[model samples]
Target: MEVVQTIAELRARIKTYRRNNDQTVGFVPTMGFLHDGHASLLQKARSQSGLVVLSIFVNPLQFGPGEDFERYPRNEEQDLAVAEAAGVDIVFMPSVDEMYPTPTRTTVSVSEVTTRLCGASRPGHFDGVATVVSKLFHMVQPDQAFFGLKDAQQVAVIEQMVQDLNLPVEIVPCPTLREKDGLAMSSRNVYLSVEERQQALVLSQSLQQAKTFIDNNVSGSFTSEELQRLVSKHIQTAPLAVIDYVEVLSYPTLEPFEHSHSITTLIVALAVKFGKTRLIDNLILQVRK
Candidate 1:
C-alpha cells in the first residue's frame, strides 16, 4: 500500500482512479490508532470497491477542550500495517497543520441529530465531525464511504450532511465490532486497567439487557424513558462505571424520548466512564412482530 501525506498527491491519485468509470472507489475515514473495528471497515470497503482509500487523521476539530486530542493514541507504523493487511490501496495520513493551515471561519453543522446523546454530552463534537468529514468527502471524492455503526450518531450526522449537501457519494454503515467478552472495541480500551476493563463489561451488559427487553416487547410495551431508565439502572450497578447517558431514540431521526410510538427500529446507546477511560456502545433494535 502507498502512503501519501499531501492532499495534492492524494487527490491526483484518486483522480486517476476516477477517470476510469468502470473502476469504483471506496473510502474509509479513521484516526491513526488501528484496531479490529477499523480493519473491519477497510475489509468491507475492499470487498465493495475496486480500490479503497483509508485516511488517518486525528481530527482536532472533533475534540473539545480538556479532551484527549493531544494524547489520543498514535502509532502510524502499526496503523499502516493494519490498513495494508486489510487491502487498503492508498492511505492518506495528513498533518494537522497541513489540514488546517489557518483556522478559518467555515463550519459544517447538522441539526436535531446533533442535539442529543453523545452530541449533547460533548458540545461542538458533532460539528467537528461533520466539518472534517465534509472536507474529506470533498477532497477524496469517492463513490462510497464506509463507516462503522459503533458511532451511530456520527454515522447519522454524516448521512444527513451528505444528503443535505447533495454530495456525490454513498455513506455505507457497517456493524460495530466487539471483543470476545462483548465490550465494544475502541482505541480507548488500551487506557483501561485490568480491573477497569472488567468493569467496562457493564456497558455491553446494559445494552444487551435493553436489547432483550425490546425484543420481548415488540408490540411497543415500553416508553422511551422507561427503557432508558432500565438500561441506566443496570449500568449504575457497576461500582466503577459512571453513567454518562443511556438513551433510546427513534432510528434515523434520533428523535427525543417521550411517549412511546410503535416504530420499526429504535437505537439504544450509552456512554460510561470506567475511571478516566470513557467507552460508548450502541445497539439497533428492529421491531419484529
Candidate 2:
C-alpha cells in the first residue's frame, strides 16, 4: 500500500483510481493506535469499495483541555503495518499543521444529537469530530465511509452531518467488535493495567444485563430511566469502574423517550473510567412485541 502525508499527494493518487467511474472508493478515518476494532473497520471498507483509503490523524481539535492528547498512543510504524495488512490502498497520515495549517476558522456542528451522551460531557468534542471528519470527507471524496458502532453517537453525528450538508458519501456503520473476554475493543484499552483490564469486563457485562432486562420486558413496561439505572448499577459492580453516563435513547436519533412502548429501536450507551483511561461501549436494542 502506498502512504502519503500531504493532501495533494493523497488526492493525486485517489484521482488515478477515480478516473474509472466503476471504481468505488471506501474511506475509514481514524486517530492512530490501530487495534482489532480499527482493523474491523478497514476490513469492512475493503469489502465494499474498489479502493480503500485510511487516514490517521490524532486530531487536536477533538481533544479537550486536560485530556489525553499529548500522551495518547502513537506508533506510525505499527499503524502503517495494520493499514497495509487490511488492504488499504492509501494511508493519509498527516501532521496537525498539514490538516490545520493556520488555525481553523471554521467548524461543523450538529445539534440535538450532540447535546446528550458523550457530547454533553465533552464540550466542543463533537465540534472537533464533525470538523475533522468534514475536512477528511472533503479531502477523500469517497463513495462510502465506514465507522464502527462502538461510538454510536459519533456515527450518528457524522451521519447527521453528512445528510445536513448534502455530502455525497454513504456512512456505513459496522458492529462493535469486542475482546474474547467481552471487553469492547478500543485503542484506549491499551491504557488499562492488568487488574483494571479484568475489571473492565463490567462495561459489557452491564450492557448484557440491560439487554436481558429489555428482552424479558418485551411487554414494554419499563421506563427508559429504569433501563439506564439497571446498566449503571451493574457497571458499579466493578470496583474500579467510574460511571460517566448510562443512557437509553432512541437509536440514531439519540433523543430520550419516556417509555419503550412506542419506540422500536433504542441504544444503550455508556462511558466509564478505568483508572485514568476512559472507555465507552453500547448496544443497539430492537424492542419487539
Candidate 3:
C-alpha cells in the first residue's frame, strides 16, 4: 500500500518496522509488469511474514546489451493494485539513479553452477542477478525472500549465492503458476501476438511430453534421449518457435543427466523464440525412489 521511491526512504521505513518489533519481513524483488506468478510469490510472502516488501525495479545490471531492457514492460499503478491485493505492506519502486548513482565496480558471481542453462545463453546474466539481489538483500535485510520456481536456475543461483555469502535470510522457492492452456505466466507474455502466443504453448507442451515419457516407463529412465527427441519434435511442430535450449538438468545443481535412471530430480527447462519474443518454461520431474 505504501510506495517508497528512494533507497534511503525505503531503508528508513524498514528500520522503523524492525524497531517496532516487526520481527519477520518477506521480500519479493521483481521488475514491473507483474502477473499471477508474481502475485503468487507476494501471497506466500504475506502469509509467512508480518511485513511484505515488494521491490519493483527493472534492474539494468541484470540485462544484456541486446536484451529488452528498454521495452521491458511497466505498469506501476496496476502492479501496486496487484501487490495490495496480494497483501503486500510496502512496495519499494526505486529509480535507476537511486539504485546506482555511479557505475558499479563490484559484481557477484556464483561460479560453476551458473555456467549452464540460462547462464550459457545469457553470458554474465547470473553475475548481474547476483549483484542486484545482493544489494536488495542488504538494503531490505528481510528475514525471508520469495522467488518463483519458474526461474529455477535463478533460484539455484541465488540460493548458492546466499549460502556462500552467509546472508541471514531464508530463500523460499514457490511453485510455478501457469495459464489454463499450460504456458507459464510471464511478464514478457505481453509481447506475444495472438498467433505467437498460441505457438508459445509448445514450450510447456514439450515439457509435458517429456513428463509423459517418464511416466510411461519409456526406454530411457531420466535422460531419455527419446524424451529430448520427443520434446524437440513437439517444439518443431510450432514453426514459429525457435529453440534456444531444451535440457534436463539435475534439480538444484543444474548439471545435465546423461541417463534418465541416474536422475533423482530432473528439471526440464527451455527457452524459445516465437517471433521476436523469447519465452521460457519448465517442468520439474521427480523420479520415484
Candidates in order have lDDT scores of 0.89, 0.92, 0.89
Question: Where is model 3 poorest over a 10-residue stretch in terms of lDDT?
Answer: 218-227
Best candidate per lDDT, number? Answer: 2
TM-score-better candidate, 1 vs 3: 3
Provide C-alpha RMSD values for all models, in order: 1.3, 1.0, 1.3
Query: Which number leads on TM-score?
Result: 2
lDDT of 2 by residue, 1-289 (tens): 9999999999998998888768799999999899989999999999889999999999999999999999899999999989989999999999999998999999999999999999998999999999999999999999999999999999999999999999999999999999998999988999999999999999999899988897787576778999988898888888998988888998878999988886889999999998899999999998875
Native-to-model Cα distance after best TM-score fit, residue 239 in candidate 2, in Å: 1.5
Write candidate 1's Cα lDDT for 1-289 as tens digits.
Answer: 8899989999999888778757889999999698999999999999999889999999999999988898899999899889979999999999998799899489999998988999999999999999999889888988999999999999999999999999999999999999999999999999999999988888888889887887677576678888888999988888999888888988988986465566668888888888777789999887564
Model 1: residues with Cα > 4 Å off, grouped in runs: none
Task: Flag regions of model 3 displaced more than 4 Å.
Answer: 218-224
Please give each candidate's TM-score. Answer: 0.96, 0.98, 0.97
lDDT of predicted model 2: 0.92
User: 219 in model 3: Cα distance from truth in Å?
Assistant: 8.0
